[model samples]
Target: MVLIKDVGSEKDKKLSVSEYIKLLNNSLSNLYGEVIGEISEITISAKGHVYFVLKDKITGYVLPCTIWETNYLLNGIDMEIGMEILIKGRPEFYGPFGKLSFITKNVELVGDGALKKAYEKLKEKLEKEGLFDNSRKKTLPLFPKKIAVITSNYGAVIHDFTNNLRKSGFQIKILDCRVEGSESGPELALSVRALRGEDIDLLVIIRGGGSIQSLAGFNNEALVREIANFPTPVIIGVGHHEDVTLASLVADASESTPSLTAELIGRSWEKAEQSVDNIQRKIFSHYEYSLERSSKILRLTFEKAKKSFDKILKIHDNTKQSLRHGMQKIKEKIKETQNGVSDKKIYITQQFQKSIDEVNNKCLFNIPKFILKKYTKIIKDKQDSLKTLKKLIETNNPERQLELGY
Candidate 1:
C-alpha cells in the first residue's frame, strides 16, 4: 500500500543543491533530541520568531537555533546571554542561505537557579497583572454534575482521578492529549479552547507529579491565559506539592494531585448526601416519637373509658336490687289487701319490668357503642395525622424529588 524511499541506497547519485538539502533535512529529522547549552546570542524578529546561538558549556561549540513565535511565547522564558537552556528540535537546512539551523519546538531553562528565576519572574508579572487575585477567581459550583477533564489518556493519572471520585452520578467528559514534552503546551491550550461552550459545569485539568522541567507545559503563558479566561470554572491539579505551575495559579482552583482534585469536585455532593441522611434519621426519629405518644394516649383513653363503664354497671345493679325489694314488699301488701289491689299490682310489675329492660339495653348496647365510636374516631384522627405527616416528609424528600425528575 505504501512505498519506502531508500535515499541512502545511492551514495554516488548526483542531485541538485535543493534536492541535496531536502535529503539532508530528511536525515536531520530523525536526529531530534534535547540539547543543553548556554545562550551566547539572542534576537527576536519583528514577526516574533526567535533566533539564538547556544554554545556548549563544556566544549565551547556553538549552534544556531530558531523557534517560531508561537512556540517561543508558549514557553514564556526570557532569553539572555550566559543563561543555560535546553532546546528540543531537529536541524533544518536553508538552501538559499546555505545554512543549517536547529528548529526548536520547545525551550526550557536548564539549571534549578535559572528555572527558579524564570518562574519567579513570570509569577511576579502575572500576579501584578491580577491574574492570581482571589477576587478574580471564579467559584466552583457547589454541586457540579457535569465535568470536563483534560489530561493525558496514557498514564495512571486518569485512573487515579476516576477511582478517587465518588459514584455521585456525575457526567464526565475526558479529552485525551499529551501532558508532557515540547508539544504538550499547545496541545493543552487547544484542548481547553476546544471545550469552550460545552455543556459542562466544571473544567478540570490534571496530571501526576513531576519536576519543574517535566511540568513545564503547565507553566506555559498561553495555557495560563486560556485557563484564566475560560468561561467555566477551571481546576488544575498538576505537579508535586511544592511545584505550583503558572496555569494552576491562574485557575479557579488548584490541587496537588489528581485524586485530590476529584475529592474537591465531589465534596459538595458528599456533604449534601450526609445532610440528607441526617435529615432522614431525624424525621424517622420524630415520626417514631409521635407514634409512641399517640399509642400512649390511646391506651390511657381506653383505661379511663373502662373505669367509667364499670362504675355505670355497678350503679345499674344497685338500682335493680332496690326495684326488686320494692316489688316484693308491694306484692306482700297486695296479697294482704286481696281482690281490690290486683290491677295495681300488675301495673306496678309491668312498669318495673320495662325500666329493667331499658337499663339492660343502655348498659349492654348504647354504652359500649358510644365508647367504640369515640375510640374509633380517635384512631381515625391519629391515622389521618400520620398520613399528613408522611405526605409532608415525602414532599420534602430530596431523593424522592430526584426520582420524580426534579
Candidate 2:
C-alpha cells in the first residue's frame, strides 16, 4: 500500500555535473546490495568514519569503501587489514572529488575463518586482561528476587526465558532491543547501561542460536566489556551447539539456549529448596533422637527412684519391728523384776515377826521365875529365925531352952 520514490531514474533530462552526481547519489541509495572482499587497507577518521580498500581475492581488483561512524559502530566488528568481510551498502559518486566509492551501511565478517580469527583475537586480548578469569566472575545469587532481561522482544527468547522460571516471586523486567543485525551490539550495550544502576540481582541477555555472522554482536568487544563490568552478575545465553561467544566467556554464567538460561536460574531455586528440605529432615531426626533419649533417661531415673524408695520403706519396716521387739522385751523384764521384789518383801516380813514373838516369850518366863526364887529364899530365912526364938523361950521357961541354944 506504500509508494517509494526513485530519484535518478530520469536519464533523458539534461543536468550539470553537480546535479548529475547528486542524482547519481540519490539513485545509489536505491541500489542497495552487498559486496564480499578482503580488506587490504583501512583507516578510521577522527570523526569515526571508516575508509577501507576491499580487494577481490581472485581477480586482484579492489574497491574503495567508506562507512559512516554510526554504521561502523552498529556492526561493532574490529576489521583487520587481511580480514575478509561483507559490506552492505550502495555505490555513490562524490561531487567535490569526482570520485566513486562504496558507502557501507552495515558490515560483517564474511566467513567462519574470519569469525574465528576475530573471536580468537578478542579472546586473547581480554584474557590477557583477566576479563575471562574465574576470579572475576561474580557468584550468582541463590534466589534472585529481581531480574533484568535484555533481548529482542519479537522472538521466543523472552517467552522461553519467562516460561522456564520456577520460582514463585520474581520481578522480571525486560529491556527490549535488537538482538541481531547491525545495531544489536550498540542497542544491547545501551540496554545493559540502562540496567546498571537498577536494583537487580541478575542481568540476563538471551538470544536464539544463529550463524557466526548472525551472532557476531555477542562477540563485540564493547558489549563484552559491558557485560564484564556489569554490577550484577550476567548470564549470556546466545548460542547453540558448541559455539562459544566472547560474551559467554566473560559473563558470570553462560548457556546455549534460552531454555537453558532459564534452567540455570531455576536450578538455584530447586537446589535451595532441596537444601532446606534436607535441613528440615536433619532437624526432625535430631529432635526425634533427643526425645527418645530423654524418655529413656526419665524411665531409668524413675526406676532408680522407685528402687531407692522401696529400699527405704523396707529399712523403715525393719526399724519399726526392732523398736517394737525392744519395747516388749523391756516390759517383760520389768514385770519379772517386780515379782522378785514382792517375794523378797514377804520373806523379810515373816522373819522379823518370828524374831519379835520369840523375844517376848523369853522375857515373860525368865522374869517370873527369878521373882519366885527370891521370895522362896526370904521365906526360908524367916522360918529358921522363928524356930530359934521358940527354943530360947522354952529353955528359959524350963530345960527346953538349953537344948535349943546348942
Candidate 3:
C-alpha cells in the first residue's frame, strides 16, 4: 500500500505527451510557417489521410507528412513521384503512429525549380517598382571621397576590391555578408544598411566567381529594395561575363568582374587628374600674362616729358594698379576649374597667351625701341604705295602714257 502525500495544487500537474504535442501544434500555427520544398511522394490511404515527404535541395532534409483534408488537393491533378511544391502547412504529430507530419492545407505547384521561381518573382517586383529605370541612373563620381564594398568576408570578391582600391589611392569601407544560400537576403540587407552611416560616396556590391545559384542572395527582393533606396550610388560587380541578375539592373552601374569595376573607377580618376593638369597650366600662364601686362603699363608712363606729364602718369599708374588687381581675380577664377564637373567650361579667352607675349615684348628697358620704329616706317611705306597706285590709276593710264612719252 502506498501512502498519498497529496500535493493538491494544480501547478503540480504535468502535461500529458499528447497534450504537449497539441500545444506545440498550436504554437507552430501561431507562428505561421511556410516553406518551398520538393515532394517525394503522394498517395491515398484507406483511412483517407494523404501522406507525403518534403525534402530541401541543398540540405536534403526529408519530412514525412500527412494532410487531413477531404478535398484540399484536387483529384486527378496527378501529383507524381518527384514534384516540387510550396507547402503552406502546420506541423502535426500523430500519437498512434509515433511519426512526425506536416498537415498542409494550401499547396502551390512551382515545379522543382526554387531558384528559377525566386529569380522570376524578384525580377517582376523590381521591374514594377521602377528600380531599373534609366532616369534614376547617376554618373559615378570620378574622385570619390570613400567607397563602400559589400560582400562575403575573406573571399576573392572582397580581396580583389580592397587590394585594387588601396593601390589606386581610394579609401574603402567593407561591409561583410554571406554571399550564398538561405541566410543571404538578411545578410545582404544588413550590408546595405551599413552603407547608410559609413559616409561612402559610392557602394560596390560584389561577389566572387561562382555559379548562378551561389549569387542568388544578391538577387533577393529585400536587398534589391535596400539598394534601390540607398542614398549613395551603388555599383554591382557580380563577376560573371554572362547571366546578369536583377540586382545589376537596379544598380547605378554594373561590371562583369571585380577587377573590371576597379579599372573603370581608376580610369575616371585619371581623367580628373588630367583635367587638373590642364587647368594648372592655364592658371600659371594667366598669372604670367598679368605680370607682363603690368610691367608694360609701368614702362609706358616713363616716356613723355610734356605739360601735365606727372598728372597723366598718375592716371596711368592708377589704371595700371586697377588692371593688375583685376588680373589677380581672373587668375584665381581659372585655378578653380579643376574640380570634377560634367561638362567642361567652354568660354576660354582666345589669344590670351599671345596678349601676354605682346606685353612682355613691349616692356623692354635695356633694348632700344628701334624694332618698333622700323615696323612703324614699314607701315607708312605701305600706305604711300597704296596712294601712288590710286593716283596713277586716276590720271596716267598706260595708253595715255604712251601718247605723252612718244
Candidate 4:
C-alpha cells in the first residue's frame, strides 16, 4: 500500500503558470499515489518513456500516465493497451503542455481477472501474427541425449519427471527457477538465456499443478517470447488441463504432466525398439518357411528318382527273360529241322544272339546311365536354388544390414 499526501490545502491558490505547476507538484507530492484502471491507450517514445491513458471501469474517468524508461523496466510489467493494471505514483502538472499527468513510480498487474484480460489481448495479437502456427514449431529429435530442464528443483514435478523417463542414457541438466508469481518473468528469462548457448538437444520446463494465480507466470509475455525464439525446441508441462498458457502455445511440444512430457521425449527410442522386434520376428518366420519348403522339395525329388530307378530295373529284367525264352524256342526249332538245313539254323541262331547282345548293352549300361544323369541334374538344380535362397535371406537380414551401416 502507498501513502496518500494532502493535495487539498493548495488547491485554491492562484499563481503564474510555472508557479502554479510548482505549487501543485509540492502539494500533490504523494497524492493520487495509487490508481487502478484499464489502459485505454499507450504511446512509447524514442527515448523509452511510456505515455498511456488509464480509464476507470465504473466512472468512465481517464487519467494520463507517464512512466520513465527506468521505472518502466523496474516495474517488470509488459504493459499493453486495454490491460487493467495497478500503478503507484503522484500527480504532476506539466507547465509547458498545460496538462496534468500521473508520474508512475511502480506498476504491476492486478488480479487474475486483469491478467486474464491481458492474456486474451496478447493471445489475439500473437495468433494474428502467426506465432502459434504449427509450421513454425520445431520437431523434437528422436533420441535427445542432453536435455535442459527449467523448473523448481524442490518440487515433486522434477522427481516425477526423472522417475518417468525410461531412457537411462539421457543427460538431464536442471536449472531451478521460480514457477509462480511475477518473479517467474525475470527468472525464466535468465534461464532461457543461460541455456541458449548450451549443447543441449531439447529444453523442458515443468511444474506441479497450481491455481490460476500461481500458474499465471506461465502466461507471461516475456517467457512466451523467449520460448518462441529459443535456440532449441521447448517442451512445457505446467500441468493445467483447462487452460493453455501462451508459452505452451509457442513451444515445440506441450503436455499436461511431467510424466507425459518424459514419455514424449522418449517416444523415438521406444518406437525404434518395437521396429527391431518386428523385424526380428519377420526374419525368423521367413527363415523357417525357407527351410521347410526346401526339405519338402528334396524329399519329393528323392522319391521320384527312386521310382525311376525301379522302373528301369524292371524293364532290364523283362528284356533278359524274353531273350532266354526266344533262345529256348530257337533250340527246339533247330533240333526238329536238324535233318532239313543245318546252315539256315546256324545263321538264324547267330542273328538272334547279335540282337540279344545289343539289347543287353543298351538296357544294362545306357539306360541306367541316362536315368542317373537326369536325376543328378535335377538334384543339382534344386541345390543351387536353395543356395540362392539362402543368400537372398542373408542379404535381406536386418541385423546384417545394420552391421554394414545400412
TM-score, per-candidate, Cα-based: 0.73, 0.62, 0.47, 0.56
| Least accurate 10 contiguous residues by lDDT in model 4 | 336-345
Global lDDT scores for all candidate models: 0.83, 0.81, 0.66, 0.80
Could you give candidate 2's per-residue lDDT for residues 278-385 as a string of tens digits? 999999999999999999999999999999999999999999999999968866665665566556646655675565467456654565777757755764675567
Best candidate (score: TM-score) = 1
For residue 379, what is the lDDT in candidate 3?
50
Candidate 2's displacement at residue 393, Å, is 82
The candidate that wins on lDDT is 1
True lDDT of residue 130, candidate 4: 90
Which of the predicted structures, 1 or 2, would earn the higher TM-score when compared with the native? 1
The CA lDDT at 292 in model 4 is 92
Please estimate how well model 4 matches the true structure, expressed as its whole-model Cα lDDT. Answer: 0.80
- Residue 63 local lDDT, model 4: 96
Q: Write the per-residue lDDT of candidate 4 for residues 348-377, one digit (tens) a residue.
A: 557755765665666636567777677557
Q: Which stretches of candidate 3 lie over 4 Å from their true place?
A: 1-121, 138-142, 166-170, 181-183, 266-268, 284-406
User: What value of lDDT does candidate 3 attain over all alpha carbons?
Assistant: 0.66
Count residue pairs with overlapping backbones in model 1: 0
Candidate 3: tens digits of C-alpha lDDT, residues 1-406: 2222337753444567777677666776764557777777777778766788888877989877666544232211223456676666677677688776777654444532655665666577668878899898777886786888787786577667656653556777777777774346556776687678777788888876565556655656667777788888889888542457667888899888888777766777777777999999999999899889988776665554443687788999999999999868755553443221112211212253355356457754444589656655765685577467546643544444545764
Across residues 1-406, which tens digit of lDDT does each residue of candidate 1 receive?
2233557884456567777778779999999888999999999999999999999888899999999998887766778899888888999997788988999987877766777787788899899999999999998999999999999889899999999999999999999988884358877888898999899999999999887667877877778888988999999988653658889889999999999999999999899999999999999999999999999999999999999999999998999999999878766664555443445545655775576566566653655787767755875786577567656755765444545764
lDDT of 3 at 404: 70
By lDDT, the candidates rank as 1, 2, 4, 3
Candidate 3, residue 173: CA error in Å?
Answer: 2.1
